[model samples]
Target: MKKILSVTGALLLSASSYAADLTIYTYDSFVSEWGPGPKLEKAFEAQCQCDMVFIAVDDGVSILNRLRIEKTKTKADVILGIDDALIEVARGEELVQPHGVTVTGLKQELNWSDADFIPFDYGYFSFIYDSQKITTPPTSLKALIESDAPVIYQDPRTSTPGQGLMLWVKRVYGDQSDTAWEQLAKHTVTVTKGWWEAYSMFLKGDADYVLSYNTSPAYHVVTENKTQYKAAEFSEGHVAQIEVAAITQASKNTPLAKAFLTFLISPEAQTIIATNNWMLPVVDGLTLPAVFAELITPKRIGFTPKEVAEQRQFWVREWRSAATR
Candidate 1:
């Protein structure tokens, strides 16, 4: 009897070890301890009864490049943390398939009609400042450019928020974007590779302001109980970023990948994403924490994915030339 029981236990352990893995590719910040990845993973695994694996890349753009490089050999069942800015690129590469889930009543600032990618969370890009440090924050892009206030931002080539800022400036200035960058370059203290490093520098008083989300102050208010941090409202209106997720066309686990996408929009997973990811939930009828209620809702401005894809390179080049000069 003892020998039989030992053999049965071994088989059980082997089966457990061989459970299917649902691999998700996302940005590095999404998987961090402070981000929504772990909690969402745990909740998803409970229902999936499979191993939930996350592969972190540097940013949304990197996620797209990596998927293209891997092609049909990709291990990614689903790709998360991609913002609306790159949706056209993903579609152009044919990296993702239609989710086939009928979504309705999304309460996001932007109307999402893409059948391939599903919106998970969204926010408006804005400059965050410490009230004690800068009493009068710039109310417009032109004002920020002309001000002597020290500012730190991320690079568009490497960061989503950085790309958003570039887009924001372009949208606000139009043909004069180069002129805007030339003036703004005077106040730029340093350009980091990613959002975390830049935001960290801002928190450490490395600069007077940092490019971040309008909802950023909610995290400090809810988690740290610090009310001094605030996102500045701009007259030019802020750029909206709608973060999304989709199943890769090459996913072997089609049903499982679809199931994970379904779970992503569920209330339980959304709540974790909203509070932890520091962004607004996409679904309707979900109550946010009181701290989130205190956040400033900016006038949102954005471009279609196709428009962004076409103009991004040109804007980046113009920005680079002006900033370097």
Candidate 2:
């Protein structure tokens, strides 16, 4: 039973690696200079006496797409960056294998239990607003969608946040979601291709709200020392996107891959991920910056991977038909 300290000396895992080369598939930004890739790669190499190669793809979904194309012929030993929403699709496609790690030291709120995928970092999808401009943010997801306040969000076709908003709407609105999308389109400033474009528009005061993460404010607070940006805390629980990793079926170095997975949840790596990725750690009790403590610790809500995988296309089509009308 590995409990997050407020106790002592918990979360212990043996680091074991083989001499074989291991290739990991992940998103582009994840392997960027500022991202956690270099640090994580160095740390793992120190413990695991093996060559760990990181293969880059466009985004989380792209990794799955590459797997779909390559299957057993793929060169990847481990795959990372596919979030909880896509895990079921990946599993259904048989792109990943079970890591067989005994899960412990996870935040209880996550309520996580999966044999194939290992959660690394997570963030709640949220609507961001500048406190300097809007004093009263919408109190809940329902209010935000219903109100005429100008809002900007991403397109579900290209952006993770866009897909997250789709899930949030479905989770909260259910059968009435079609009507909600129609309502949202009324005051929507514009839907951009990605999170950055929508956020850039919001920063220019083009809109009152932009779809983003609860951790968005922390970056402003910590880096710029400007705290006007804030994530709205909706009475309806927010949808979360948890980035996860799994062993590929083509992996020749299973032991090394599993070791790398275990290392990801370790305190050392969690600390790196939280700060660098601008997301919360999957495990508990890692020391993060003061701004992290200030971020909203909202109640988690939304569908499972299986639910999202099954209904994603349906919801995307739903958004496409109704969002601009």
Which candidate wins on TM-score?
1
* lDDT of each residue in 1-325, candidate 1, tens digit only: 2332343334334334435998999988899999999999887676556898999987776787789899899999899977899888888889899987666557744567888998889999999999977788888877887888899998887788989999998888888888888787888999988888899999999999899899999999889989999999999898999999998989887677766776677777788999999999887667788888878887878787899888878877887898889
Error of 2 at 144 (Å): 2.2
User: Which residues of candidate 2, in runs, are more than 4 Å off?
Assistant: 1-21, 204-206
Per-candidate local distance difference test: 0.84, 0.84
Residue 170 shift from truth in candidate 2, angstroms:
0.7
Clashing pairs in 2: none
TM-score of each: 0.91, 0.86
Q: Clashing pairs in model 1? A: none
Candidate 1 regions with alpha-carbon error over 4 angstroms: 1-19
lDDT of 2 at 295: 94
